[model samples]
Target: MNNIHLLDLIQGASGALDYVNSTVTGHHRRVGAGAAAIGGAMGLEGRDAADLVTAALLHDIGAFSLDLRLDGLDFEADHGDHARAGFRLLSVHPMLSRVAPLVLHHHTPWHRLPPLSDPGPGQADTPAAALLANIINLADRVDVLDQVGTRRVVRERIRQIISHNAGTVFAREAAEAFLDLSAGSEFWDKLSGDWTHVREAVDLPMADDLISHDQLLPFSRFFALIIDFRSRHTATHSLGVAETSARLAALAGMPPESQDRLRLAGNLHDIGKLAVPVTLLDKPGPLTQEEFEAVRLHAAASESILRSVPGLDDIADWASQHHERPDGSGYPHGLKRDALSLGSRIVGVCDVFTAITEDRPYRPGMTPDQSARVLRDMVGQGSLDADLVALLLDNHAEVAEARREAQARAHVEFERYRSLRVDGAAHAA
Candidate 1:
């Protein structure tokens, strides 16, 4: 296990979530900033503050997996199902299990909360968790409120809303802290202006336990779920790429560490695609120039999201460059042959291979021979790396087997997600 700042990873995940919908771009970050401010005002220090911010950033994670049309809905209107879904997702992870309940009750009103003294079955029902959840509830509501016109007018209106909900939607202490913090114009300015800076200002206590590459691999897989789970067409895309890339790296005789990094890069290469609309991604017909341009921006977005992590810089670079061509005809940053690293080249190859071999909305999966021809054609056009393509072709059976196995597992997960939606809908109806 390696010593890593867990907060940085959370921030990166938050960045990916921001891309899910451009309208809600900074929603998570703003909520996190507000929660941290409220936490500070309530005299929370060290780990308490850090945990609050972490929960806030991931508070809406369940929404990503949901089918809800969340474009303009207010916090109270959306209810608590997504909160329950998010709690279930986070609680499964060892590093994030502690904050699971905070997310679960983020939308729960203070009046409905169980008394802190008699928390229910789970530790998640404790006073600390409730306080953190209430703070997130207040912060999330604050971020979604209208902020049009003058700062003074906006602040006054927001303050009134917060005050009106006190002891009900908002815990009295959390509401009081936010009300006190809102009196200053700086608070409003930071919320509307540079929320990233505000979030960066607060330092989270470092984790004493370190995570190794083996342990960290599960985190990458989790992200793959977040990226591909949004639509059925792309459900197995990231996992296939991860498996294919690792297999290719092994065939190329790269060291074990390089192979692991390659697999991680493959899992994250499409992390930026979260920003592209699900409709756009699932469109069967050809895209408009504007839509294609939006699709192209994911590469750059992937880099921006992952670049901030401490030990993941190399992985970030490779993942971001997955779309770059050897001929400098690629998007985001059209780096030429020599400028691209070997790891980048391998990921680029695997990404294209996986896409061609996978079932897409408009097209069926290609046969191995068919995919080989397309890859060869790209190589001839000076786009793909010829040597890598040749190596992949030489080991076609092994590469295909790896991709099938990985994607088969992803298919099971996708079916499970679909089943949940069906059950939820049936229950609702």
Candidate 2:
């Protein structure tokens, strides 16, 4: 295969930053293209543009390592370390080094830097990499809001949201420019990435390994079921929440495909919990410090296991980032504010609501009213999205009914489900 093809494969499989990649499944390459177009529009030219494109493609590599070790975590793992790890791993690759630092600190934010070369110890400060790093960072956030396809929103919806977030981290000019471009007619269609190159690119074994959307759905559901299977305390937890969330998204006028993705993400949001020891997950009482740290690794773990499965990688961000907080205090990646995709953000709220409202091993479930109150408090604190939370609360009665119905459904249809595979070979041929 050619070098470009090889690099895209490696980057795609890297699962580093969790920005625009496969964590959302059907939207994987499309999100990457969005980031790239915005980067290009920013006048990031030549090798710099390629680097941003490369970084944009594989920003979530840190997830793979974190998820791999989660299934039986004996120690408290800090997933925030993934950005640096992804940077290091790609630094060794000839094609990816330019993008490595960009990917590394995508989670660390541009404003909170101590300089790329820390004056103190050998620990390098990565925040001062370059403007491209910052540019790609903003682009990632823009695509996540994705004002497209959801009941014919105003063209300026993305702009309005970005306009509201001008200070602190994102510059008013940059955000406004992104909004300016996104408000145009052709941007949304082009934002999803230029797939013509991918189609015409030279073929390879790995390219043949690409997983399609259909194969991933069942796998995603089953993977989420594994989260419940890990302990009686959490059995069917994700599926129940998934059904609830999907039903809610449908009610709120989200497109059918987007709603399907939300439900799938809700179902698998806790798959990272699989790597956690049953001892820690099933504890009858509150977790110790060390134990809580172990609990945080599951999201990272979920990201890892799903990375290898090709087409399903986008779901990783949604399924895995379910626990991320908007305030930068959440675990896995500490992805604050606009760093999260809308689907992931929605799943985050749904995960909390479903878990709190459902029966648990240690305590009685919170009433829907009580869970609504708690979710409201979280929104007030910036832990969840107020808008999505409001949507859920608005339809809580109907969602509660769906949750009731999902209780009897198995995560899969049993006899019809099979292991996920890709027709990469056929595609290549």
Candidate 3:
């Protein structure tokens, strides 16, 4: 695999979060821009400022459910739930360690926040991380205010809100920096433009260098969590698919590196589902034609999102083509068997297997015999690759055991995620 651009990958993953609702479309970008501008005014530059923008882009990532995301639009809402969730999700990943603490405390009020030195052993230096979190808090509120009303009206309202919240809801220094930037037309002008302008306005570096595929795994898992955790119906779907795909690739004698790539592809395959409504995903009955069409778009949407980052062309194709069929009966591109790569076929097969065997809100999982029959029917109809289907069915017990173990581990994580409200409560008290 080629080295992937870190910023592009970060931005691409961020885009998935912003895709969940129209109210949040470009919301992350706006906050990133605002935080970068404010961070600059407060004398933050280089890695500190860049990490601020990264945290801003992913601040709402913990709001996995549509309900949690929608609730965020309420300026007075308790954001502790998602804040803790985001922190836990990000803190476990090495690449996002610096950004994690900021995300955890982004909604914590300046007065209520613990001392700067509290983020002990192995944590990011808290003085900077704490300030950066508050900067993000201020920037987040500014964007939320900007979301409604005319530009002039919104700007005035934002001015009043910041002024009212300063020194309490916001750190005094961060609030002052925001006010200073808002005092001039240039800051808002740069904000009104693209993210590129916002990055340029703050002198944030955009690293163009690529990193190894191994370096991208944490992010892949992160994206998987974001994609799957949106609904209980899919809490472990991506992980299951990822495990099944990698296992299938190994059974097919694919190279270890290639197996890893397929694993990543599986993790990201449903990223486009972020654009899909939870109502549709969790519906108990069959989808109407319109709803089906909306759900079907996720494949193409996944391709579009993954393709935006460089060095992910193969990943994009493998992920997007999971819905494609040998008989050219699948969606998005509807390519025939000849057009599909082995990697794509593996993902497609794994997706089918996982979907059939996983319990859903509407139905229980099929037994192995039942699942085998279904797979045979699919292969007979040219819906799945005959060879891959046979390989899975032939090794059904091993595959099923592997998928079950993977999802069991995922279930532990999901339980921990769901239980974060307790953590939030303890912290609040």
Top candidate when judged by TM-score against the true structure: 3
Query: What are the candidates' C-alpha RMSDs?
Result: 3.6, 19.7, 2.6
* lDDT (tens digit, per residue) of candidate 1 on 207-246: 3334577767878888898789877678889999998999
Query: Where in model 2 is the C-alpha error above 4 Å?
Result: 1-212, 411-429
User: Lowest-lDDT window of 10 residues in candidate 1?
Assistant: 420-429
Tell me the spans in candidate 3 whose CA falls farther than 4 Å from its real position.
Answer: 149-152, 194-201, 205-210, 420-429
lDDT of each residue in 105-146, candidate 2, tens digit only: 554444542244432233223442445555555665555455
After superposition, the stretches of candidate 1 with alpha carbons farther than 4 Å from their true spots are 1-4, 45-48, 71-75, 114-123, 146-153, 189-200, 206-212, 361-363, 418-429
Separately for all candidates shown, the number of backbone clashes (residues 3 or more apart, or on different chains) is 3, 27, 0
**lDDT accuracy of residue 306 in candidate 1:** 84
Which tens-of-lDDT digit does each residue in 161-250 have in candidate 3?
A: 898999898988988888888988987877676545343555676554466788887788878877888877888999899999999999
Best by lDDT: 3
Cα RMSD of predicted structure 3: 2.6
